[model samples]
Structures are given as structure tokens and as C-alpha cells.
Target: MLNYKTLLFSLGIAVALFSCKNQETEKKTETKRPNIVFMMSDDHAYQAISAYNDKLINTPNIDRLAQEGALFNNASVTNSICAPSRAVILTGKHSHLNGKIDNLSKFDTTNVTFPQILQDAGYQTAMFGKLHFGNNPKGFDEFKILPGQGSYYNPRFITKDGDTVIDGYVTDIITDLTIHWLEKERDKEKPFLLMYLHKAPHRAWLPAERHYKEFTKKEFPLPETLFDDYTRIHPEDLEASSPDAASKKYNLDQPKSRKSTAAKTAEMNILTHMVLTNDNKLKDSTVKKLGIKERYLGDPTNRMSKEQKAAWDKVYDPINKEFEEKYPEMDDKDLMKWKYQRYMQDYLGTIASVDENVGRVLDYLDDNNLSENTIVVYTSDQGFYLGEHGWFDKRFMYEESFRTPLLIKWPNRIEAGITKEEMVQNLDFAQTFLDAAGVNAPDEMQGESLLPLLKGEKDAWDRDAVYYHYYEYPAEHAVKRHYGIATKEYKIMHFYYDVDEWELYDRKNDPQELHNVFYDPDYAEVREMMIKKLEETRKKYKDSEELDKQFIKVYNDK
Candidate 1:
């Protein structure tokens, strides 16, 4: 029998042991959730980033994410259009399911987004820069979005308070707002989802004052397929009928045999349709002498202030004069070279600003001690054509336009300098973010979480192929509607609506995608296998002829 003192002492010791054990258990279970900083640029190409290919441009800041974390070699999008691609990212579903099939279609508000789920799970959410569609973005605690294809100079931002036009380069302004939110507005206690998007490198590529001077002086190497003739279009077909005649033949109920008009129908050839004054920044008088008319839109410089206009003239005036002097001697080939150079100068210049601003955000994270617990992701809305296939826009299932750049860094979690070849899409971003935070993704979400792949768990991922669709046709650029499945070795696309064509590519043999091997007898076995895969993928995704007809009806009505 113990005395009173001994019994009390024993009781106290037991209580202390129990309390310590409980605390240890709590500590083990309560893992700190990671903050996500998602940075996306508009129309940024993988080829432009030096991490993927150093031949095109040197993007040291963007490459920093790739060096410090994992670079996805096979990251792509479901759809290649801007607004539709964005909708897919937000909803984690394909365009057909999300009801944002094309840029003209309104976004379905009833659908749940990952940001909404994150916000519900006690994560602080914010979005800055172009949403590209809706003004009032759901699930964000704070947002300042660009009003539908915002300008490069003196861009107007729509905010919760009201619309405010900030007077600076749009790229710098967007970065400034993002950093400001990080430093001032972000809640310290909770995890955050920050979307810092850029409007630069979109349409009418306008660079900041600092970049245009040097970029204009430097000439970039032309793409090998810059002067690509439409080899898919036959000689007789070229003289058969125009796009207008083909549109009339396309029946609403039952489509006609449009054949393989995919290559020739589009008006995206950089030499002809890319207007001199709208895209290339030629002086109005110089364009008049060259027999060029402003076809795309009015001069992009018309929105500039006096000082901005003066600075633009200071750089472009000399280039215009040189072009005018060379116009007499310039042939079609010479003109193509000149136009390609001009396009690259302005396009790449915008990217330089994006790279600089990305460095700013990365440094802020490092300086603030947020690097260890934060997940930083970098990507684009979708890949752009940097003169690949003799085109300047994205509306195709081709490799250059289909593939987007994806880099993710999470200190002490993801191993540095890793490259993943698994086929991941923007569709996976939602579930990945939710999974990283220990939140359950909604059942309606269709994307697989990339958390395992990000953490270097290669065997945990088993996806061998990805799906792609493009649905903006008889519209700008005139890219025919198509959807396909892409494995590492092969790709098959079916162009429909105005044309019914099944095109296949042997990716391993022809990396440039210069040849279509659909009708080749040698590839019959491969074609049969790919066709079965395509049908299975389409069915797995719940896309059917009914959905196709429904979307076509909506488009025709519009």
C-alpha cells in the first residue's frame, strides 16, 4: 500500500505521460497543408521556354521552376482554344461536359470548380489577371480580372469594387497586383490558392517599352516548316471550291463527304492573313505602298497614350522605313522571312517581360520563407504556334499547339531536377491541388490527381495516352473541328463538321508531323489499334454522337 504522497505522485506521472502521448499523436496527424501559387501565361509555347528547347528562346526565370522541381514532358490540354481551355482547367472536365466548347459559348455557372472546393476546405483563394470570360469569378475571396481579351497597354481590370484602368504595361501591372495581394491581402493562418495570370503574349503581341528595342534588333531562326505548303490539299481540290462553297454544302442533319480539307481551309497562314498593320506594326503609309490592308482589327497602337505612342513610333518608325526600302526587291519568300521575323520580335518580347515578372514572384516566396510550404506551378492556358505549321494561333490537334508547358515545385516534397513523361493534362490540376491539401475532390471532377507523379512516384501513375479536341470552326482561323487520342508512339485525329477526315501520325518516325499515315498500308495494324483506343477513350469520357450533334446545333444556332 502506498502513502498519500506516493499515490498522488504516481497519478501525476501517468497524467503527464498520457498528455504527452496525445500531443505526439496530434502532431503526427496534423500535417501542414501546402500553399499553391499557380502562374499561367496566355498563349505561351513550350518551345519558347529554354527548359524544353534552348534553340528558340532563353527563359531563365521560367526555367528556374523546372530546375528546382519536376518538368512534365507530356503535359497537354483537352481543348486548344483560350476560353474553352481555361474552362477545362477550372472545371476539371472536357469542353463537351463543361458546356464551354468554344470561345463564344457562355460558361456553365452551375458546375463546381476546384477553387470553390478549396475555398470550402478553408483555403484562401484569389485570382489576378485574365479570366478571359466571366467578370465575376466564383470561389475567389478576391479577384481583379481582365475584361475579355484585355489590352497590352493601359489595360482595364474589372474588380469587385469597380473597373479601374491601370496606366502601365499590362504584364508589369498584373505582377504588381499579384505581389501586392501576396504581401498585403493573403491570410497568414490558412493555406492559399493564388492564380497569377498574364495577358501578355496573347493577340496583337505588344511588348513592354524595355524589350521591343533589343528584340527587334535580334532576328530569330525561322521554323523549318515556315513556308509549309498544304501537302494534304490536292492540286485539283485547290481549284475545286472555296471555303464559302464548302460551308453551303455542309448539311445540318447529314454532313457531306468533305474529305481532307483540314490543312487548306484555315486562314492562319502567317504570310497572307496576319495583317501588316494589325500584327506586324508597319506604318499605315508603308502598308499602303505594300498593298496591305488592315484586316484583323484597327491598329493596336490606337489604344496607347501619347507617351506610349511616341515610344512605339521611336522603335517601329525605323523598321517601317527599312521595310519600305526593301519592298521593291522583296519577293514572296523574302516577304515571308520578314513577316516571321517581325512576328517573333513582338511575340518574344512580351515573353521576356513575363519571365522577369515570374522571377519577382519566385523571389518574394523565397524571401518571405514561404518556399518550403508552398507549391509553385507554372503553365500556359494552352500552347501557341510560334510559326509552326506556318500558323500563328492555336486551334489544332497538332503537337505544337496541343502541348502546354507544365512545371511544379514543392520544396522537401517533390524531388528537384525531375522530368515526368506521363501524359498529364490541365484537367488534372484541380484534383492534384485538392489532394495536396488533403481535401476530397468532388465526384463530378474527371481529372486524376497528379500528386503521385509530382512526388516522383512513377509506378503510381498508369496513364498511357491523353485525349484532345478542338471545336472552333467556320470561325477565326477556320481550323476544322477535330478530336483525337495521343499515345507516346502515335496520334489519330478525325476532322468533322465541314470535313470528314481521319488523319494518323507515326510520332516516332515523323516527329515534325509532316506526313499523314492514315491511308498507308504499312500502318494498317497500328491504325486499327489506335482507332479502338480512340473509341474507348471517347466512350470512357462520355462523349458521343448525341453530344456532338447537340454542340453542333448550339453552334449553328449561334
Candidate 2:
């Protein structure tokens, strides 16, 4: 009995409402695809983490991630160097496959990275902070990265559009970029992949002013192997020497009255600071005061030998006058202490700034609702030796240099207060991230998915062993090129460069790895069994076929 016009109008309204409802449904479905955020810290260690029971440092925000989700106690890197580890994390492939075996090596970015896969799947991807792989980030939609080891204070970042040299602490700058990307430019219809990387507690332990005195009062406990003589296990010829010996011996502990004292201090400080800040430039006054008598500055033709006198003249002429003016009464010891304290302050100050920025990033994530959907992972390039093993730099296969701290959190998916003891590697992180996003990982990746382990499904997976290789030898740390296989119970290593040797440690009996048992009569059978397993692993992981032939060479050389 309704009129035709009225009936047509009612039908039109119903169609409009139905269309709107369908659009809303589609929007909800899009948002339901989980967003992913992966974060990392350079050279952060498990021993430094308060959550892992070492109470000397306060990393409350990093600890919060573990509290909210899961902490993997045994996460390790495949190649324990900065570039190689990062490459593995990006490509989910071993160093051999990634073409990044050392810090100086370049990465081949043509291969499928998890970010690229996510982007292909309609996710918007972005990376901010340190990306030191020395290749253009191919998969990310947007990226702002530090040029090499970015400064702890006022770092310089390079972007696809242009390079940006920002005037804030590095951590804060990275976080700011991340939040800005999230709030402004990101597509609301698509899920996001935000990578927030940090340069914290890396070499030179440069903390900010706030964290300067944070751990100053508490004496850091010396490592168990602090005084270990290399002659006992590793022969003197094979043992890697500390990089900071020049600093520690001449600048750190030596009396500074010697004419070359200031010069040595300045040199060490410059090298140390350079690692933290790429923009580090020595002041004229600092140079003069340090008595650095070298000035090959303008003469390209002047060689180090030919310019020695000229260099000495240029370096010391002003310094000598300054020295006479500044310290009429200062003795050798006084000058030494002054130089040592200055170096320590600058280095530790940088570390404080990094920690403060960490707090800032944590605060930002919390402020945004995106934190619930995000997974924050904090780790380092590799572990650093802070006077451990009498060393300062990394690259050795030792525990202090090899074991990095790994903290992860995903609010909705991961279970809180769970600690996984499975042996995990940095190489596995890429696959894990891809798995979390339900993306297909490429076949070239050597890592296995850790999703089940992260989710508290302990019985769902079984991985018994982890492998390690360090190829950059006779360079910075003088660490011999070595490869090793470690399990939950034992570890077997072979050093093939410089001096060929094999080392074995039964972790159940000697957890500290103080004694090498490759030559032990008690472990002969164990050694035989491990050798077979190691070969099998090498083949399975597609490691160099040369490893098998080199084992005998290692034994014969030793």
C-alpha cells in the first residue's frame, strides 16, 4: 500500500547503510593484522641487565619488556661482529650467505629481507637508528640510519631523501623519528613495521650526565676469569691481546711525567671517542696540550718517516709552550690521573646519554597505543669487555665478548615472566620476526622460527646446539679466526688462524669454561662424538667445506 516514491527512498537508505557497514567491517579486518616493531641496542650484555640478576645497573625499561613478555637467556649471534650479526638478523641467513662476514664487508641487499616481505604484504615498514650493514635498506618503505657507529650525543643520520644531522642524543632522535612516522605519515589502513634501533652501552661505555654517578658508587664485580693467564689454556701465541693495552698501560696506569704521556692519552682518547661519535674532532688547545708533535696536516707528499721531524715540530711546539704555562707544578702522577679521569668521564658520560634515551623511547612507546601491538627487542652488536679478560673491544669468542643481552616483549601474544633457556642465535631473529607477522621466509635463511619458544610453548620445539664463527683475525682485537659449536651441555671450539688449536668445555661440570679439555683423556670419547656432530652441523648449515680439512691442519699445527 506504500507509494512508489516513498518505497524507493526507503530502499536507497537501506543500501547506503549496508555499504557503510561493509566498509567498517573491512577497516576492522585490516587493523586486525598485527603490527610489528623490532628494537635493538648495540653491545648490550646479559650481565648488565638487572632482570637477569646482576643488580649493578638499572635498565628498568628493558626489564619492563621482559616483565610484559619473554626473556631468552641463551640468545647468541652467528658471527659475533657488528655488521655480520646485523646482516643475519636482517636476512635470516648466516654470514656466509649474507656476504657480510666482517665489519668492513658490505651486505647484498637484493635478497628478500623481512621488512620487504612485510611491505609486499601491504605493511608499511620503517627503520630508525643504527643500521651499519653499509647497504641501502631495500625492503623498508622509510629509513633514517646513523652513519656507521652513530654518536651517543647529537648523532648524524642518513635518509633516503637526504642526510640529517640532528642536535640531540642519538637515542632520543631515533625515538622521535619513530613516533613521528607512526603519528603522521604512516598509512592508517595498513599494519606497520617499525624498527627502533639504539646505540647504547657500546664501546667506551659512554653514559649520559644523569647516569654518570648512577653506578659510580657501586664497584662493578670483576669477571670470574679476570686474572686468567692465557698460558694455562690458550697458549701465549694463540691468546688474543687486549686492544686497550696501550691505553691501560701507558695512559690509564702509567705516570704521565714522560714527554710522550700526553700524546699517548690524546691518541687513545681520540680513538675511543671516534668509535662513539663519527664527528669527533680534536680541539687545537687539546692537541697542543697533549704534546702531540705530529703535523703531516698539509703535505700529502710527506710520508710518516720523512715528516717525523716536521710532524714533531708541528705537534710539540705549541704544546710545549702550553704545558709550561698550564702546569708549572704538576708532576707525572698528577698529569696521568687528570688524563685518566677526563677520558673516563667523557666515555662514561656518553653511556649515560644512551641510557637516558632508552628511557625516552620506552616512555614514547608507552604513551602511544601502538605499544600493545608492538614487540620491543633490545640487544647489542655483540658483548663488550669492560675490563673483562683484560680487554676493552670485542671479536673474541669468549663469553664476555660473545654473549649479548636479548630482551623481547609483545603484549598480546607473548606470555609474561617466562624465561626461555633454549640456545637461540641472532641469525634466528629475522625468521622469528617474519614468523610473527605470518610472512613466508626465504629458503636461504639459516635460522629457525622461535615463535613457539617465545610464546611459552616449551614442548613444541627442540634445538640442541648453536654454532659460532669469527673470521676477522689479526685486525683490531688480534683474536684468531675460530669456529665453534655449543650445546646446552658442552662447547667445542677450534682456532685455525695464527695458532691452530681445539678447545672443549663441559658446561655442566665447569660452567665458567675455565679449563680446556680437548686434550683431556677423560673427554676423548666426548671429543670424538662432538667432532662428528660439528661436521654434521657444518654441512647442514652449509658452512664452508674447508672446515673439515682445516680441523686436521689445526690439530697438526698445534
Candidate 3:
């Protein structure tokens, strides 16, 4: 009915409208991929999180994540060492497979990391904070990480472009870098993956001045098993009986002198910095009197002349006075206990800064309308023993050191406050990230995707047990080399350092793993069944061959 010119005009308008509509739809589809922010705190434990019903202290930021998403109740690590555990998380492989079994070992960055995969898949990936694997972080489009275990106060960062030392608290610097990247460098057209790792609450616990007085007025309640004597509970053959056990041991009431020979030696090394001019050489008397022992105390090399010894005596005089004042009546054990308390105060206080920074990240997401599209995850490198089993550091197969807190939040998906009791490990993090990005996990990865569990598809998932191995032996923390398998119902740990010791725990009856039933006459069948299961797990995970080789290599090398 319309004229030819009118008909042609109508068709042109319809085509223009369709084209605009298609462009809008394409933009919406492109933005549908979720942005992921993964955060990790150094040495954070499961029992320290308030969301996990920890009544001791508050972790509001960590609690918020749990409240808004799923909190995994039984998340653990394949290895309890810092570098090794981090390597496992990045590669989704066990320490043996990754060849990063200890802190001193280097990480192979050529391997595929989830961030690398995401980068390849057209996502902007940035890592800000501690990437302590001692290797260059590959695959990240932008990276500003601390060179090893960074300082708590005014830490240094190794940037992707250059080595620039930023002045501020470690947490503040990390957060600033993250916010800056988000505002300036991140691509708005595609999703972004940001790894925000913190160097808080590590050894020599140093807290910011603001939080220094946080726990000064209150005394943390000593753990119930503070006095647990490993008489019958732990086997003599266990790796916990290693010679280096003395280093990891802690007491509850003793204060140690902060100025020991080691401290003085460190001070003397820095004293050279105070030398006014190049012409001023270190005085021989000053050097000799500093109690700088070259070797054993009574060795001929350590012997000093009267004047030299006198100077040494003067330098050590303050140390002796401080030591005597700190522990006038207490023995070494009691003195250690006092030091532990002070250490705990500083350690827990450091966590306050971490909690505060976590709040900042959450607030940023909410303020920018990114909360709905962001998947937030909070966890730690590994767990630490806060006076548990009379220990202070990690690397043990014990429950306190093995389990880590894992919390996740995604506003568009996942229910709030729901806790999944399924056994999960750090190795699963890579696959979980890959799954979130709709990317297929690599075949070499040992972890299973947790997407189903997060999506409330528990019935459709098939996972029951998780494998663990700690291979760093004759190393730091003195925790014996061990391997084990943990299921929902039971746990079996085998210590191979000494007389082959086996620890079996019935989780349903002994959730705390207080009792070792490997020697119980009634559980003989159960022990055999668990051992068989352990063997089967080793074989299934392709760890048996490596374990055998490691056992032979350790003895042969020794």
C-alpha cells in the first residue's frame, strides 16, 4: 500500500534499530563474565575467623565474606609450608609435582597458572601484595609484589616495570596499589582477576602503631591443650620428635631477652652504618668486645685476649642484665612461656590491620557497583599453631597447622552463611578460578572444580577425600616429612622420618584428633582399611612412585 520511496525508508530505519539492539546485546554478554578478587593472609587460621564461631577476636571483613557467601568448613593445604603451599594453589598440583617442596625451592613459572589461563582468555590479571614463591610471577598483566617475606612496616615492592620501594605499611601499600590498578590500568571491557595477598601476622609479629595497643589490655585465653605433654598422645617415632623440635617448642609464661648475642651481632652489623666517615674504620677493640664469636664458645678461634674479652664483656653486659631481669626466678621453659604471650599479643594485633584492609576492599567493591559482578575469596597460605601442641610455627600434619580458613562470596550466585563440610584443599583454588571463568582445567591439575558445591549442586558432585603431603624435612619448623589422607570420617598420617609411625584418627568420634587409635586393639581392622585406602590414594594421585623415590633419596643423600 506504501509508495516505493516510503517502503525503502522504513526498511532502512528497521535495519538501523536492529543493528543498535544487537550491539547492546553484545555488550551485555561481554560483561556477564564475573570479576574475581582472591585475597590471602599469611598464617591465618580457621579458628581465628569470627565467622567460624571464633569468639576470641573479631574478623569483620572475613566474617562479611562468610555471611554473604559459602564458608568451607574443612579446607586444608597439600603442604603446610608457605612457599610450597602457595605453589600448590597456583598450579593445582602437589609439592612433589610442582617441585617446590620447601621455602628454599624455586617455583617454575613456565607451568600454567589460573591467572595465566585467564590472561590468555582475554582477562586483565593483576597481583598485588606478597607473592612469596621466590619466582617471577608470569601470566599476570600487572604485578607489584613484595620481594620474599616483606616487612610489616614500610615494606618494599618489586614492580613489573622496575624496582620501586614504596614507603608505607605493607597492607596500606598493597591496598593502594590494588586500588590504583583498578582505577587506572584495569580493562573495563573485560573481567579482571586480582590477587590481593597480605604479609601480616608472620614471624617476628610486627603491627602498625594504630593496632599496637589493640590487645594490650586483654590477655588471650591460653589454648586448652597448652600443657599437652606428648607422652602417650604422640608416638616417639613421629616426626614431631625430630631434633629441631627444640626450635619450634614454646612455653606460656617466660619472657626472653630481646637482646641476645644474635641480636647484638645483627646490631653490630648495622653499627657499621653509623660510622661517620670512610676514614673511620671499625675499632678492633669494639669488634672483638662485641662478643662476635666465630665458632663455638670455647673454640681457640673464639678465644679472646684480656682487653678484647673485657670489651666483649661490656657489650654483653646489657644482655645479661636484661636476661636476668626478665627471668629472675623462672627457668628456660617458663621464660619461653612469657615470650609466647608477648608474641601472641603482637601476632594477633597484626591481624587487626589485615582485618581493616579487608574492609577497605569490600567497601571499594560496594561503592563501585562491582559487588554483584565480583567473586570474592578470602583464605591464607597455611595454618599456624598458636600454642597448640606447644608449638608456634606451621609445617606439621596436626589439625591446627593443617587446616586453613576458606570463605567465598558472589552476590549473583551462592547462598549466604551456608557452610560446606566437604573436604577441600589449596590445590583446588586454581580449578575453582578456572571454572568461574568458564575455562576448562588442565589435565595435569590434581584438584577438582568446586563450582558444583558453590552452586548448591552437592548431590551432583563426587568428592569424598583429600590428599596431603609435607615433604620438607631436615628443614625449617622441624616438622618431620609426612604424608596422609583425610576423608570426612577419618584421617591417616604416616611419618617416614623416623621409625615409620602411623596415626589414625576417627573424625566422627574425635574431631580434634586428640587420640591416636593406630595402636588400639579394637581398631585393627579400621587401621588396615585406612592403610589400604592410603595406598590406593597414593597410587590414584600418582604420588606412590615419587614417595618411594623421595624416601630412597633422603636416606641416600643423608
Return the TM-score for each candidate structure.
Answer: 0.91, 0.74, 0.79
Give lDDT tens digits, candidate 1, residues 305-372.
99999998999999999998898898988988899999999999999999999999999999999998
Stretches > 4 Å off in candidate 1? 1-30, 232-260, 294-296
Residue by residue across 1-558, what tens digits does model 3's lDDT show? Answer: 999999999999999999999999989855588899999989987777788756567889889998899998889998897888888999998887887877876677667888888899988999998888653688888898988987665566788677777755678778888988888888888899999999887765655656654554446776766545443243332323322221122111111221111112211111122121111122334335543323221221122346544553454344345444554576656644554465566677778888988999899899988999899999999998776655566777668888899999998588888988888989899998888898889999999888788888748566677788877665543466678998888898876654245577888898766677665555656766777777788887888745656744854575
1 or 3, which is superior by lDDT? 1
Measured by TM-score, how close is model 1 to the native structure?
0.91
Clashes of each: 0, 21, 11
Q: Return the lDDT, model 1, position 214.
A: 83
For lDDT, the strongest prediction is 1
The window of 10 residues in a row where model 3 has the poorest summed lDDT is 270-279
Ranking by lDDT: 1, 3, 2
What do the candidate models score in CA lDDT, each in turn? Answer: 0.87, 0.64, 0.72
Please give the ranking of all candidate structures by TM-score, highest first, separated by commas: 1, 3, 2
Root-mean-square deviation of candidate 1: 5.8
Which candidate number has the best TM-score? 1
Error of 3 at 430 (Å): 0.9
lDDT of 1: 0.87
